[model samples]
Target chain A: MKTKNMISIWFFVGCLLALYGALILAAGLQTYSNRRSANIAMQNLHLQGWWGTGLLVIGLFYVIRFRPRRLR
Target chain B: MTSIFSAMLARTWAPTSLIAAASRVMSLGGIDLTIITLYFFLVLGLGLYLKKFTSTGEDFFMAGREMTAWIAGLSFISANLGSLEMMGYAAATYQYGILVGHAYWIGAIPAILFLALVMLPFYYICQTHSVPGYLQLRYGEATRSLSAISFAIMTILMSGINMYAMAVIMKVILGWNIHFSIWVSSLTVAFYVMAGGLLSAIFNEVLQFMLIWLGALVIPVAGLIETGGWAGMVRRISENFPGQDFTHMWRTLGSFTGNPMGVHWTGIVFGWGLAISFGYWTTDFLVVQRVMAAKDLRSAEMGTIIGGLFKMLVPLIVILPGLLALAVLPFKLVPETMANVPGVHTYNEALPLMLARYCGPGLLGLGVTALIAGFMSGMAGNVSAFATVWTYDIYKPLIRKQASDQHYLSMGRWCSLLGVVVSIGTAYLVMNFSSIIVYAQVVFVFFIVPMFGTVVLGMMWKRTTPAAGFWGLLAGILASFVLWLCVKLDPSALRLVAFSSHAKDMAENVYRAWWSLLANVVVTIVVTLFTKPKPEEELKGLVYGLTTLPSLGQLPIFKRPIFWAGAVAIAFVLLNVLFW
Candidate 1:
């Protein structure tokens, strides 16, 4: 029962991540036209640049990796 | 007439004895100014009307958890928005650029989403009166007690600064002494809030938010037009601060000291938005109270998101004004302009200054009233939340377990009055702090982030033991305080030890302190994961409803979408960093 519950919670988290990913992708595509220039230096980018992209992918994976385990 | 106006301004604006003398004479017949008096009556009337809702403990304290989504959303915004955010946003926008504006967009929206999609489910399942009530069910007596105490302390400290911010404005505008302004501001709100409990608070807050929105937004629009349109305003600013990038959305991240108003980067933008939004949406009682007062879990969830939508429109009211102020004043005239205004100083006073100067007499009075409304509503919110925790979490359980519901309801009001006095007194006592905006931002970073561990773990991970929750909360807080001490001690501590310190360096960048928050959450979660899970019986009440019978249904599409919409909104807002 506990295992089943854990699976359910993870499944919910996964859904949130997937939704987060989709939104990021949509935002990226939507704003791509408006974004004419990316002026960041490499060092700055290394520190925090891919934040949007990174968060999106992580969110997507969280949803994808989530699965409901069968109740013990 | 010009002499009278200047004399009046001088009386309020002048240093020392002359200012006080002028304040006394000017205030002789100004006791009941039209706009301020009308607002005072309005607050009193609302409390009287809400008296019907104050019959029961639940009714008075939580509005019977039945507020509509719109009211909940508006009241939530009003309660927490306060003078702190209003003034801070204006100052930041004046000095920096739209990067600070992203705070509302990224943080507020995502926070609402988390509350709607994530936090709501747990609240619905647990069905506790207060969020800490949920803690009691999830952890135990000690955890609940500690959380309640910590929350009360935090609310007092935070509210104390908020009171100071409001009192400073009133002190300047009315030419009242600091002590008089503090009492007048504190007592007016306290009286109404004491009458109706949370119901009165919610009632007045709806009106308060309307005034706050109008005063903050309309002043900027009028100022922009007065300074010539957006193009004119921009042209004027560029000419003075030549070649300074005033268009970048993420400029702070580009250079550590990069021209914040120009060029681009996302470090501070992302940092502030992420920290404030998450903390506010999930942890802060002032915001969480509105969610707790929802008629049902869905209402609570949806109400928070609706508030996020309102937040998205805030920059139009707040951030734009600073740019307008900058454009209107000549570069050399900036200091003189500030000096000329009797009650305006710092970033918080910019909006007030714009209104007092540009707005006509009737509208100027209205604007002043709006500022007062914003402040009183914030005070009422703190008092109400403090009282709720005190009555429900402390007094009922510890002081009088057998007390009647009516007694508890009455106790709530007394608690609110006590909270009001303590907050006002604390504000007067702590006059030597940094700027209100920085002070508010700093407090939230240190105090709130550590709680993310307990809240997130409590909701998601059943393997989180009670012991883990207790120890995690304690350790996380300890870690943050230690970090705070380290920053103060690193150079100063050595200096003190050697008796060689003359001038101290500015403390570490706020961004560095924010990293401590992240560390606290990690430590709490990692510790929780390693501890033995709670026994199933103890966990069942929190993990699932205690109905003893099961009647399950499908999840709503909007519930999920509503949550996603928040995340989507935040992402779009972050994309603004590109314009940086």
Candidate 2:
């Protein structure tokens, strides 16, 4: 009998990071539009948007690459 | 109540205070809470999904020995990378300057390499389910029982301490209810571990490792940017504290009074670099079990080498942030005792303080989730290890010798639940009587050194008798306890153990471990000479001279364990010299 492959841990990690990235990116866009100053240092760099985009890209790559496939 | 528990933890670990800053508590925003909630859902989902694969006893206890090198390697380090170590070492860096980096480098790397290149083959060949199982094979049931019982008690108590510490941190940092944090986290861990066992634990540990890096990485990056770079940070620290060598790792080690930690170079080398480091990395089943789950002998060795590499980088997230806090944070951090005053922060608050300084809403949530992941993963590691040892070493052998594989699997699940419950009980016990934490530390110190001595002797020397292993371990424990009591009764007597009047509690610990290990080795040698040795035939496959080590000649140098270990060693030396 052919054994089924278990879901990769990276898939879960990817999904979580992707979801978090999108949420953070939306929040960042809202903050940017409102032109409100956050209490954190280096806020003007728009780190939220940058970091969120980075996470989204990496997360999406991991999700796609490690996604479970049926064994033949 | 939270402050009291924090104070107790501060006292137990010493110098690295866990007290909250006197400033207002930080609360999570909606986005942040959502990220944290999603983590809970994901872990539970993973556990439920993995249940079908965990039907057999081997699957439940060992992940069916099917884990790849990467999975096993990441989980191995993650199991040790708990919130306590992260927070404590960061705080240590803040207090003692860069000298604390020695713990991550010299204190860990060589021993980890030893485990990968030398010790792991024996464990892999033996097919032992746990460290105690290996002991039973090398010695006898008596030795196994002693090690397993002590380990079980220690693990559960440690899990409880981790639980309580996390709850207190949550209460102090986020103003959450302590009971709510404890119960929610404990029940979640227990449920998932019961469902999927070691596989579930390993999966979550790998995820936690990633979360920890991403969440905590922001602080060091932002700090470096703000303070220029490594050179600028060093200059700032020197300017802040005049006439002090806080940036150099080895320059201040010539004399005990030369460094903030009051430890000499000898203590760092023989005591920590040899005894304590070898004791933990080689023998601790919690981390070793992860490697034991690897798919092959090469996978196990490669996994350990992988762990050693990541361990070398952990200083970036943990130690560098503490250094950054000293150079960049606007407010000065006092000791835990002085943290009660307004605007005063404890050294332990370095990590969280850096988090608040650099992280805004969504990022703040991610950082907090990373800490929570660390705490839960630590608790899960302890509970899972405890369950396995209890079922295999204690229940199966001592209580019921004859049982079906399904029966043992059922017992393993029940023990996992029971371990969590006991850990919760230990948490409350600590809440009432905080001194138990200090006692637990002393007891742990007693075990590790002696156990390492016994195991190493048993494996390398075929003439070692079972009686020698048992008695030698007992002698080491008693000798360590006596030394501790002497220091307790007469503080000046610490010189006997640590070799100097200026040596602090940390130095005393390492020296004490070295002495205990020496006592164990000497007594084992003496006892072996008097007692009848195990027959050479019986020692086959277990003893070094009698066993045939596998040939690695066919594998390429890049794939060999020795080659990677050499790479790790070179990196280790470069790091030491660069910091020196």
Candidate 3:
């Protein structure tokens, strides 16, 4: 009998983070253009873009490393 | 009136305290909604996909015992990292200052290490499906039935409480309707848990742990930067509170009057650190079920140790935000009583208020999603545990004893669905009488301390007879329940239970656990002296002297469970001293 390979939980985590990172990055760009925010502190830092980029990079690494593979 | 209108329009732009007084703290924008929607789809989809793997009773209830140490470890800690706990501890820190940190450190770390080192061997070696299953193996059917019924009731009600808490938080923070929040989140959890069982719950727990950190880490980071770092934050707190010792963990704990919590060091060390912490960390099936899924005994031990390591770091995300709120927020936060009055914020709002202070649209959504993940994961943990206990310990033993593996598997899945439905009903019931939450806590206190005593004595002493185990547990539980009633009927009775009139409600709980544990120990020991012992052959693998623990002599010293546990112990000590 041929056994099926299970999808890694990390891969799912990576996908979620990657997608969220992209959306947040786009929102950050929009925030930069609007020059308005509800946040009280560190508004000039544009934390959304920086944090989003970090998540995207880390997420892509996990995706590449743990993506599901065909069982031999 | 103009300011209130502006606060309503601008949402988070206004001061958190002011906005909380007038309306919801923050509104979810399109980006935030997208993030949350994506989360639901991902969890549900994963659950459906994993359904094929869960064809057997083992797979449904125990994740087929195939998880690696890392997976099991993350899932172990995450099961306990529910949003209710997150918010409650944070609120505690806000109310009692850093004294609450004792719960994370001394109150938890020693017990977790003890579980990995002392208890996991018996549990893993015996191959019991649930905690009550272990009880049945050691004590008999009577003990198992009592434990299973109480635990089953507790888990379902606790799941309901989590659902209600999530809905209330959503209503307070985002102005979502309570019914909409409860039903939608509960249904999503029910579907996933029913579809994939423990495996699905484990996967979501791991994801929720990550999300909780990602969402909450921003608060301390931003707060530190704004205050110039920890020293600066401490300075600001001292400046703000004047004579208060909010920054010290142990210094003010020497006297109940000296601390905001009205708890002395003895209660911190003996009551919380010894009794309550051990009772929960070592015995609670909700977290233990996660570790039981490990691929091997070594993995189980390693997973628990790893969980302890991670657990030490949780304060950064949960407690720091509360501490930061004391220093950073411009206004005082009233208790729950005055929370509804305009211009007054409650201690519970510390985390959300901090999120509002730092996170704009995109990040705000991530933070909200993390909280939602926490609530769902909590529900999933409880429901999954309930299903396992109900099917294996209750239904199989009591209802039908001769069912096939397939039948049990089907029952597990159906129980998952039934548990969620009951939890939803419980959530609505709590909406009418909120005191159910307090009753739930009282019930937890009654069971956990005594159960811990029964299990530990049964595992450590070969002479502990089944009758002693059952009667000892009953004595402890009855003593605790009576003590609790005494305190409730006459508030002055707290002085006797807690050994001081200044002891607060928090202290009362801790001291109650200690007294109950003492009652159990005394009764168990006396009964054991008179009762006949089980034969050595029957006691093998379950008791300390009869069982031969696996040796790690061949493994590298650094890779040994003992080595890592020691390292964690040292770190735990350092943290207590650093914050002292």
Candidate 4:
């Protein structure tokens, strides 16, 4: 059961990573076609800023909500 | 004329040189004037006030270990952020790309999360005053002794690197000589750290944190705006690099071969975040002091996590500016040419220099003030940690047994004074030796790796014997030294260079430092597994019990999504890593 749980978790993570990678690959291609510089990529990242903040807030909530049963 | 010449000669040898140089430098308009004035008085005031706090060893040394998580978290950030992060990351980012973000993705997030989740619980359970004390509990007195000595030496070397780095920045930015800059910075930092201990250190960091943000963040924001907003920056970046892979975080400009001396992604992620972070979060007195001082275990744990979250935004401030600088300024005639231009020597000075020249006065002054503030924050943290190590780790156990709290606190104050003097002396050595960032890395690789091995394994495995602990630690140190020798003599390692003409010489030294950490970890694990396990009595409170978990203690459950969130975060980071 534990092995199954662990494997499922890994699978879910693998898929998410694959998705993120795909998006970046697409972005990279677009950047290349458009002849983007490193700063442009960073600026684009800034322009699309709140993604990380949302992820973080979600992550924080998840960690807090699922805290260990015996915790003070 | 003859009499006037004699008088001038006498004045040259007089102590007034520092005062004269300091005042003349302070006379500069806008940014510099603000820095000099703020630096001069703030540091002096901190030192005098510390006189009151210095009455006992406990008070002087640990601030009686009564600090909050926020203070501890801030000081930890300040200590690590230093000029290196300010200057080095910015320069690196300017030259490289979002690839530098790999540092956050691979090293920082996981490492800090692991520190909080995996290690902190055990420290609270062990309930020791310091990492060394925890060592004594898990490994025995001999391992504790060895661990303490190594930690102290590393801290001194690190303080030296930090002090020198800040001095260099001040000199370059303000057009002061290295010698004059060193004394001015060292004296002021020493004063408040001597007076306040952790209290002053923490207080200064809250202020310093703001400065670091300004110097690092404000520059990038303004640079982006000046260059024509976010879209304009993107437009500019695409225009220059031409058909480049900018979106992927790991694969960016100049990252692939820029650091041929071997600080690649593996090193930054695994070596820096995993190996180095474990040692720092678990063992380093700077962070541990805060955890020990926390109002409760949960608060301590939460504060560290808060700090980690704050660290997530750091690269945005520090590294991005560096990348921006590289784009904004044309590829110069080497680092020295850029450095000699009064704004570009070290990573810390890069942003301020850019802002001063490019941005208007008010903004430039604010940026310069941030750098000074960052320097002061770093210095304050170093002094506080030195005082703690001296008082708790060294003085109380070795020097006196029946000393009063007041007496111990007083001893702590005196210790802070001595710490400042020693640190200043050490900083002078760093000034003559290497850049602060490189020096800090060398110290990290050689000194920290072995300590990490003992502390991590000792906490996890109940069967880890003191005999194993001592031998593992000894072997790790010996192994790293031997590794250092191999890298030092290697021909390929000798081929690299830094910004100086003496780059080849310094590169060889750094290569030795880098490779040694890999050797230390390998030898430590091998020695540990082969040796005997710790006795049950020694292991009792040290390792986690199957039953008594800190997070699970008496808390009612919400339909907690935290578990699912943790799972998702893992997914997100992996996706970022694999895809980007």
Native-referenced TM-scores of chain A, all candidate models:
0.47, 0.87, 0.83, 0.43
The residue pairs that clash in candidate 2, if any, are none
Top TM-score hit: 2
Fraction of native contacts in model 1? 0.00
Q: Candidate 3: which pairs clash? A: none
Where in model 1 is the C-alpha error above 4 Å? Answer: A1-72, B1-32, B261-266, B331-348, B431-445, B491-513, B541-580
State the lDDT at B257 in candidate 3.
92
**Tens digit of lDDT per residue, candidate 4, span B1-580?**
0000011111111121122222122113443354446545654654565455444454455555555666656655666566544554554444445554554555455656666677777777766767787787787778777777666665666566556655655554566577776677677777677676765666566556645664445567656766776557656666766665433564431333443222344445554456545555556666666555555666566566666666667766865665565456553312332333432233334455455534332233445666666666666666677666666666667777677777767776777677677877777765455444343444444555567677777777665667777777776666655544444466443333212222232233333333444555555566667777665655666786532665556554432223423653565477576645
All models, DockQ values?
A: 0.01, 0.57, 0.55, 0.02
TM-score of chain B of 2: 0.96
Candidate 2 TM-score versus the reference? 0.96
TM-score of each: 0.75, 0.96, 0.96, 0.73
Point out where model 4 deviates above 4 Å.
Answer: A1-72, B1-32, B39-58, B228-231, B241-247, B252-269, B330-333, B336-349, B399-402, B431-441, B493-532, B551-579
Local error of candidate 4 at residue B446 (angstroms): 2.3
Q: Cα deviation of B77 in candidate 4 (Å)? A: 1.6
Error of 3 at B390 (Å): 0.7
Name the top DockQ candidate. Answer: 2
CA RMSD per model (angstroms): 15.7, 2.8, 5.4, 13.9
Candidate 1, lDDT over the whole model: 0.59
